[model samples]
Target: MRDDVRRLLASYEPARQQPDPPLPPAGVLLLLHDRPGGPHVIFQKRTDRVRDHKGQISFPGGVMDPGDPDVRYTALRETHEEIGVRPDDVDVLGELDQMVTVSNFLVTPFVGWLDRYPYEWRFSSEEVAYLLEVPLSHLRDPRNLVPDRRIINGREYVFQAYRFGDDLIWGATARMLGNFLDLLSALE
Candidate 1:
């Protein structure tokens, strides 16, 4: 999978598109690691007490701090802070296309590879509710994907989400996963 990912990313030129400026910059990591059965991606269920996006299933990251030299720094630092993944433990592959949230955040998603399996998680009680692993094969299954529609401010918006167990992976995280899977499918 690692070799395939590298080859696909190399052959494909990511737009690296940026949304309009002045939006608060944030970074999230699409962290994939080996598990017992197969590869899986890690996600955090945010504590309901957080400031924003409370109780949402999200990647382990937050807004970029001024001390962060770049978005990659933001992603690695936040991942380490939120969970227990050490910065040195993560092998960052590359970044996907940037996305803008309805709340006006320019979110940069970074894909990182962790060769090690079964990480010891130390969740920050203040931020993380719990951590869950969604198998890559489950995500790849089209039967698990669903589209939701809603009307907001007289505009109709649709969101694609993936369901695994009782958890609903939606919003930006879902979009990012879709983009990654789309690229992976191109390899076929």
Candidate 2:
């Protein structure tokens, strides 16, 4: 499965979007680990203290620093800072489509594979509320997709979201997940 994923991503050309007056670039790591039950993806529930996307469920990542070489480096650096996963430890598979967030960030999502379980995670207490490890099976289930309605700036909008237990994944993160799941479906 891992080999298949790697091959698929290698040949995949992710879609890129360019908006007028470009948004600041950010990167997120979508980490996959093979556990006892099967493969699982890691997510962090952000604390309310975060400047943007406060109290939201997201992949481990952040805006790119000036010194960062590329968006990929930014993703690895943020993943290490946020989840204690060393950049060298991750087998980076490939990238997914770039997404523009409501917060005005051009987010590049990278898919990485982890070989081990029971990882010793040291997360930033101020940024992360808790870590959520969700099974791929649960996320891939069509029944888990729920309709989410929200009122932003006095306008109502409905979005598709994933509900894993009590945690709701929507917004940019959900869109990224949907893209990845679509790729996985193509492989089958």
| Candidate number of the best lDDT | 2
**Tens-digit lDDT string for candidate 1 (1-188):** 88778777667666555654678899999999887778899999999999888898999988999999999999999999999899999988888888887768888998898868777888799999999898999999999998868688999998899998888889889999899999989877
> In model 1, which residue pairs have backbone atoms overlapping below 3 Å?
none
Worst 10 residues of 2 by lDDT: 1-10
Model 2, span 1-188: residue lDDT tens: 77888988999999998988999999999999999889999999999998989999999999999999999999999999998999988999999999999999999999999868889999999899999999999999999999999999999999989999999999999999999999999788
Q: What are the Cα lDDT values of the candidates? A: 0.88, 0.94
Q: Top model by TM-score, which number?
A: 2
Pairs in clash, predicted candidate 2: none
Q: TM-score of each candidate?
A: 0.94, 0.97
Candidate 1: how large is its RMSD?
1.4
